[model samples]
Target: MNGLEKKQDQRRRFLRTLYDATGGRRLTFILAPDIGTKLGLTQEEYTSTTDYLVGRGWMKWETLEGKASITPAGVDEAERLIAADAPQPERRNIPAPVIAEISRAFDATYTHAQIDNIFMEASAPGAPPEGSKLRKVAAWLHRINADSEVDALDIFGRLVREFLARPRWGTDLDPHAAEAYDEEDSRFLDALAAHGLSYHDGKIFGAGLLAPSKTLAELIRARDLTAIGKEFERAADKIASKSLGPLWKVVQRHLGIAPTPELDEDLKRVLGGLASIVAGVGAFRTHAGDAHGRGPGAPSIEPRHTRLAVHAAHTVVTFILETWKGSK
Candidate 1:
């Protein structure tokens, strides 16, 4: 074939591979190398043809973060082309990789039978021929648990919040998961109040409680930790650790506590460890915190990573407040 013909074939193959791999989310972003290898195309072909395809309305580039999902028109054309090119075989069972991906994405272990049942429902009449994985999973959950009164979006949205495969910045953690964290925040405030350390006037020995606590709250809500992570650096200054470092000195000097209480040795060690836990939160905020820009090649923050941050912060605050109460 001529060079022009070869180029056309390469583009066609790449689009097809992307369609199959993402299961027609109509939108998905995958790594550049992965895309190139999957379609057996050169780096130039995969990257270069994106604009051409977009102009033709075959796909839309959502971000510079390596997005390559098909547009609505692209999906229609892709489906038609796929149908014409090959026979639609019976899906007796869903692909293992697809199931495995879902399992890993949601951290919920699922059996093949469970997945197959979901696949059957999703592939029912009038349903999308090859809907996205979350859609199928969501639909299955919505049907099986109608008595619970939860919708598919929440059922699936929780999955996305926990482990959406997309490269995006946002999170609204499930209420069940956030209960402990909320209770800890409330307890921390209560402890502060008991010690006359109001959040508004809660400074001890010149150190202060966290202000605009909204930064972490926003991080949890929107999963846009980079912006909130940036704010954490500033918030670090308010908490007496001078930027999430060891909180011992801050707790002692600023919060007006003894260097070491005359408690049992074991209890002292535990309290010291708790103080370190608080310091660790600060250190993470300063070091590997997602407070900076994650340009084209950067990855979205993992749910587990954010959980670590939130959990650590709450644990530290709660511990400090309790310790302060004990001292008084």
Candidate 2:
């Protein structure tokens, strides 16, 4: 290379070695000949380069015996240069099955280009020519997990759920009264039965509330979230078409509830929060609950979710029973 290029390379190397020796701390040292020799430079070249670097504000040259140390800025520049010079990590030409697994976990179909783009961003943690989204995601998932071993797509699923709950991230999710609830074998049945939905210990688990059974034992039992969710869908459909009058026109007609005559409050918390979300409950049951055509994106439900569904059913059912009894 030309003299100028050679000099530039030498200066970059000098900063790098200084950075390494000090560990990014301001390590003071005399301008020793050996330090220069390590970089294949004579004492004169080393001392001169140090002076030039000091002038560049990459490091501090102290007064005591011309002691030198790298500045924080020098370390950043050294790292930047080193990162730029580092060889690119060999890109993996991802296979189809791998891509399909990721696509299924995310509940979306992906094109080759989309996968390439996400992988390109997610692959290396700023080590690649382009930066990375995957490494950031990986770090986040790792932080959240203390012991669980998981795949890249599994991590992606968790992140989606996490973002789906946060206010900033879940704006699209828009917590409606519906779709608000969970899972286990013996995990949530008692909770389910307590709400008077449906649960059989061993047999006929996960059936939605098909008939208006008085107790959980009488109802078609549910074993899983999907089964319980089906019951909610049935109840919502009945209420919407029946005198319950959907989410919008309820309460005043049947439950003796209406807007306050003074302030004109529509009683949104009960009507808006609880009743309105019923729609989402039906939708959630259809999409992620134990319904058919669940497809690949159905999130595994937690027990808490099942409680929400069962409770909603209880609220509606209790209201229906109470109204029916009063009339009789």
Candidate 3:
């Protein structure tokens, strides 16, 4: 090659070598002799090249006692030069099989909303600064899609288990441990612990998992669906019994329920079920002792039985929601 070409090549090689040495670490020191030996150049050539780099505004030098250290700008130039010559490959689209595995694993332990939020956080940059676990999971998913050989479910399951088992790194009461926690972090250290589930951390340290508040919220919301379903059933019952009929009737009239055959059929079914329940209760009262054997008073409802009935209704509503809405 020509002298100009050779000079350019030398500069490129020098920058690439510097970039490789730094990797992800901050602050690298290079002695003149070491650079000379690596580049197979004499001490004078090394000194001249170093001067050339400084002249080009790519590097600056500092002397501390006898050793020389490169400035931050020098590191940046090295990285930039290396990156310009060897650009990183574009991130590949995540494969369908990997997405399926993630979906299955998430669904088994968490609600649809939780999984959805987790992905949303993963897709959005700066959305979950505190959720290292979520970041890990997103990384793993990307790796799995890239070329990871392990089973996605097993890997993801291991990660989830680990997340459940470990005390969150930041929440430890020890002063040294607490120092690691970022301020305004919303992620919890113990989520499933509040719900009575436990796991081990050692088995899943390498598995990518994220434990952002979004994921936790999704899980909690799924649990709340059961409560909401119960409330809905109780409200339905009260309305059917005319206890809250006026309110429901007003809603029905406003919504033009009578004009829709499907609405009419559903309403009929609800009223019929209530009538059957009342009839059954009345039949039981008739079989009990009358004025001669019992005191003159109305039949008393058992609070425990009412509570159990409410629970059963709630469970039924929850089942319907799960089957139809595919949530909770």
Indicate which candidate wins on TM-score: 2
Question: How high is the lDDT of residue 210 in model 1?
Answer: 32
Model 3's alpha-carbon lDDT is 0.47
Stretches of model 2 off by over 4 angstroms after superposition: 27-32, 91-328
Clashes of each: 5, 19, 6
Clashes of 2: 19
Error of 2 at 237 (Å): 50
- How many backbone collisions does model 1 have? 5
Give lDDT tens digits, candidate 1, residues 1-328: 9989887776676667767777777656645457677666666776666656677787776667666677777777778778878975332222233334444433243344544544344332223223455455544443533423333222333332333222232225566545644554455444434433322211121012332244445435644446445544544665754544443554555444433667678867866676677667665655555466334554344435555666667666555545544555
User: Can you write out model 3's per-residue Cα lDDT over 199-291, one digit (the tens) per residue?
Assistant: 232122111122333344464476656775664675565554643334344334433332345656767676445434444444444543242
> lDDT per model, in order?
0.51, 0.51, 0.47
Ranking by lDDT: 2, 1, 3
Ranking 2 against 3 by lDDT, winner: 2
